[model samples]
Target: MSRRAEHDVRDLVERARAGEARAVARLISLVEDASPLLREVMAALAPHTGNAQVVGITGSPGVGKSTSTNALVTQLRRAGKRVGVLAVDPSSPFSGGALLGDRVRMQDHALDAGVYIRSMASRGHLGGLAWSTPQALRVLDAAGCDVILVETVGVGQSEVEIAGLADTTMVLLAPGMGDGIQAAKAGILEIGDLYVVNKADRDGADQVRRDLRSMLALATGRDGAWKPPIIKTVAQTGEGVDEVVDKLAEHHAWLASSGELERRRTRRARGEIEAIAVTALREKWGDVHGRSELDTLAAAVAAGDADPYGAADELLAAFTD
Candidate 1:
């Protein structure tokens, strides 16, 4: 990392903990670039990370996930909890930048001392989160926020990546999502620690709730020791906000009492360590091998003078050796 970035990251982290909003925003932007200084700052801050309740909210598009997230953050603050929200907006495929629509919905918390919200672009769109993003989450955790909510970029499907990263994974669905329990198949049912039927004021709300309860009863017979609760919410009205927060707190407490909290933190730590190693290797590879070699290989591949797999093998050999 550049010395300037290093100094800036450290100063900004302290400022954020001191409740400097702009400093926190600037620090988040800086870390998104994956600098060496970010790794250092986060490592020093890691001890403070596991204290927060990492809640992930996901669902089909337009089911009010972002609105629900905004409500939950507000409710958390009302309950005296410091909160941070990570809204993963889809990146513009052409520009490679976040669309930020969800962030716009969360702007009410911009100046609140107890709330911090950031929109992350899914690193590989349609695949998973970016490698550097979760490390950024550790930074927020270190800043002393007691609760962190992550909004995954997807419509109805569980965000497997966020589910893996968060302490509690919630799948939010709307009234019309479906009735048959089989509709929850395909990498979706396994991740949710809870199901939220958002927009409960809409038509067919009762049907949605009944369908979800039936589904949960069937799922309870399967494997998980803890049954994921189903909650109804009218996010626009903030009606069920407190209930959601209570549910989150209940799940967090259960995890702690059952010793699952230690296991989850261990998994998070392992993921953080692996990301740091990958980042360090890529940096060394770029510095020692340089971009010129990559450009040459790319040209050869484009000209069909070299096979893509063969070129990749050559790059892999550099690290393996």
Candidate 2:
């Protein structure tokens, strides 16, 4: 990198570490845009990361996820912790940008300097997150957030991906959402570290809680495994939010004492490294739009002149060369 560019990145990192929201936002934008300077940016911020506790909140649509996240942020701030929120929203087809629905709902924190909220477009990536999310998270972690909440694009069944990314995954369910059945089908039964039945004042809330507890009972775990707790809350009214925060702290403590925190973060890092390497390889092979070595190998395979394995070998050989 140029000396000027390196200095610029250093300046941004310093400002972000000092809790400047604009600097933090700029760093995340660089990640989202896949800027050429990303490597330098990541290096600059590396030492300052690994401090924030990441919490991922996910659920089916209309489960009041935004409301719950807003409440959670409110509670966290009341405790004097710096919080960062990454709200993954569906991409707007016209503009290829976030719809800003989560940001809109989270307006309660707009004036708070200690809370930084960003809405990211899913951008057609599957598993309920933007491709840039992990990098954006590093930016937040390096920005000195004490706790970071990732709220996914409520894509239903495939939303369980949050489990792999967070230190604690909180799954939200609501009465009248048929979530009990959907939870089983979506594999959320295994992913959630804590489950919240939002809209707890509704008529069917008790039934929803019972169903969730029974389903959780059926899942077997090793000795000393943390039993996922079910908490009921009316997120709009901030009811029962303190208990949720308390549970989060309890879980974080368990993670540290049990050494699972290191394991989880290591796994997260491995995934991030593998993704970066794979992306680099794809870039080396060149884009699909142009006639590249991959296109040639694919053509040979299609014509039955070269088997897929052999073509793949050739591609790897070329890549290695």
Candidate 3:
């Protein structure tokens, strides 16, 4: 908490609140890098968060996630809403940077001041999302984005991580992507708050819709719960995009009415807190590893003198103490 550093963070927070894109981008970069001053940055931004509506879009690769996200941004902007987009891309092995392909697809919004888009690298983290997504989301929320869209890396079955981060999760599907039964097998059916069939102009689109409906009917939901709606869209031409937005609005209203919005946000916060704590513990364990205490414990376990559970407890005690 040096005076100079504190002053810099405060200035950045003020500039971000005034809607300066550079300040917002800088703040998100700090989150991504796990900066030493992260706590200060988060504290300064806390008061302005929890206002934006977050929607997550995920599916298998080639499901048109970026196109749909761009289309959704267009619709939201037309309704006079400020939009933020976080497009998570696979990390480059050498550069450790986002591929930036998704941002290229969203070039339509490049000049729109009402829209801010950032491409983040997954950095080898699983679950199809970058580790810093939640923190980046807080920055966008505090920056007065009316809606934020999170586009996952779409790494097949494990992509359900977005469900934990977004207020509304839209699982996108295309006609030839092994049909809707595969969507169920991919584990998206359980997490989606809304299902979107993109590229509806293609053949077998009706069959895709039918398969989705049939699959949804078989899957049970909470008692008196919301039934996820299925919408069709040709994202390239923006046809049927408006209906998708309308369904999103309807779902948002239902979330408020059922008190589910608060519940979801509460769960999201819980996950974020747990993640930070776990990361801290891992760092502490790394220090212990450097001391060779873990190696000593492994030797004891090898001799059958100390069981695994007890050895684990001893290692954890090294840090907790």
What are the per-model numbers of colliding residue pairs?
4, 0, 0
Candidate ordering by lDDT (highest first): 2, 3, 1
lDDT of 2 by residue, 1-321 (tens): 799999999999899999899999898878766788989988888888888899999887898998999999999999898999987654343455555644576889999999999876645332224246778899999998989999876453245556788999999999998756776876777888899999999999999999999988888852257999999999999999999999998999999989999998898887777777777787777644355989888888999989999988887888887
Please, what is the TM-score per model? Answer: 0.83, 0.92, 0.91
Residue 16 of model 2, lDDT score: 92
Model 3 C-alpha lDDT per residue in residues 1-321, reported as the tens digit of each score: 799999999999999999999999999878766787889999888889988989988888887988899899999999999999987654343454555654465889989999989877655432223247888898999999988998865353246677788999998999888955577778888888899999999998889999889888988885257889899999999988899888888888888889999998898888777777777776677568467677788899999999999999998899777
Best-to-worst order by TM-score is 2, 3, 1
Per residue, candidate 1 scores C-alpha lDDT tens digits across 1-321 of 778877776787788767676776666665665444665677566666677888877776777887888888888888999888877654343446665653466777866878888776545422235465576577677777898888875543336767778888888878876655544753556677878888898898878778777766766532245778888899999987788888888899888988887887788767766766676666555544546455666789999999999987876777677
Per-candidate RMSD vs. true structure? 3.7, 2.7, 2.7
Model 2's number of clashes is: 0
- Clashing pairs in model 2? none
lDDT of each: 0.72, 0.83, 0.82
Candidate 3, superposed: residue stretches over 4 Å from native: 90-95, 101-103, 122-131, 154-157, 289-292, 295-307
Q: What's model 3's overall lDDT?
A: 0.82
